[model samples]
Target: MSASDWQKSSYCGEGESCIHIAHAAVDHTVRLTESGDPAGVILSATPHAFAALLDAVKENHA
Candidate 1:
């Protein structure tokens, strides 16, 4: 995918340690990477897993 396909998180700060997320329509997976290491490694997760992670984060914050 191209860099244009990725979107920076709204919570991102004006620093290198920002989060970027993208969707892969081919395999139906959500991709994530850190702005500081955009060219380094990428992490892929299923939509369900990603949702679960968000839910857990929300629960903890609640």
Candidate 2:
């Protein structure tokens, strides 16, 4: 993704090593990376997989 495509997580504060996500340039996948390590490994997930991950996280909190 380009510089303008990646969006920071709204829940993060300034200077935090948070995660960022961007829509894939040419596919139906989400791209994830750390703000502090932009050039590091980029994890990709389908829409369904991403939703399942969020569901699991929410369930853990509940």
Candidate 3:
């Protein structure tokens, strides 16, 4: 996927440590990457897995 297809998270600050996410329609998977190193490792996960991860993070913080 192209860089333009990736969206920055709303929770991100004006800093290099921002997170970017993208959806791959072909594979129906979610992609995640660190904005500070766009060319670095990109992680792919199923929609369900991604949602679970978000839920876990939210619960942990709460």
Candidate 4:
């Protein structure tokens, strides 16, 4: 993938080492990787799994 395919949200503001998220053009799955370790680890999730993760995070934060 090209550099342009990767994206980060501006919601993080400045000085944040947030992870970058990109969706696969072929499978429509989510891809996750930290900016700090671009070549390190990558985590992929299906739409349903990702949604469940969001729900869990919201519940924990609440």
By lDDT, is 1 or 3 better?
3
**TM-scores for the candidates:** 0.82, 0.82, 0.83, 0.71
How many angstroms is residue 13 displaced in model 1 relative to the true structure, after the best TM-score fit?
A: 0.9
Model 4 lDDT, full chain set: 0.71
Output the number of the TM-score-best candidate. 3
Model 1 residue pairs with clashes? none
Local distance difference test, each candidate: 0.82, 0.78, 0.83, 0.71
Predicted model with the maximum lDDT: 3
lDDT per residue for candidate 2 within 1-62, as digits (tens), equals 56567788887888747888887768879878877454653688998998999899899999
Positional deviation of 49 in candidate 2, in angstroms? 0.4
Give the worst 10-residue stretch by lDDT in candidate 4. 32-41
Sort order, lDDT high to low:
3, 1, 2, 4
Pairs of colliding residues, candidate 2: none
1-62 per-residue lDDT for model 4 (tens digits): 45566677555656537777777778888777766343533788898998899899889999
Worst 10 residues of 2 by lDDT: 33-42
RMSD of each: 1.9, 1.8, 1.8, 2.5
**Segments of candidate 1 deviating more than 4 angstroms:** 36-41
Give residue 30's error in model 4 in angstroms: 0.4
Q: How many backbone clashes does candidate 4 have?
A: 0
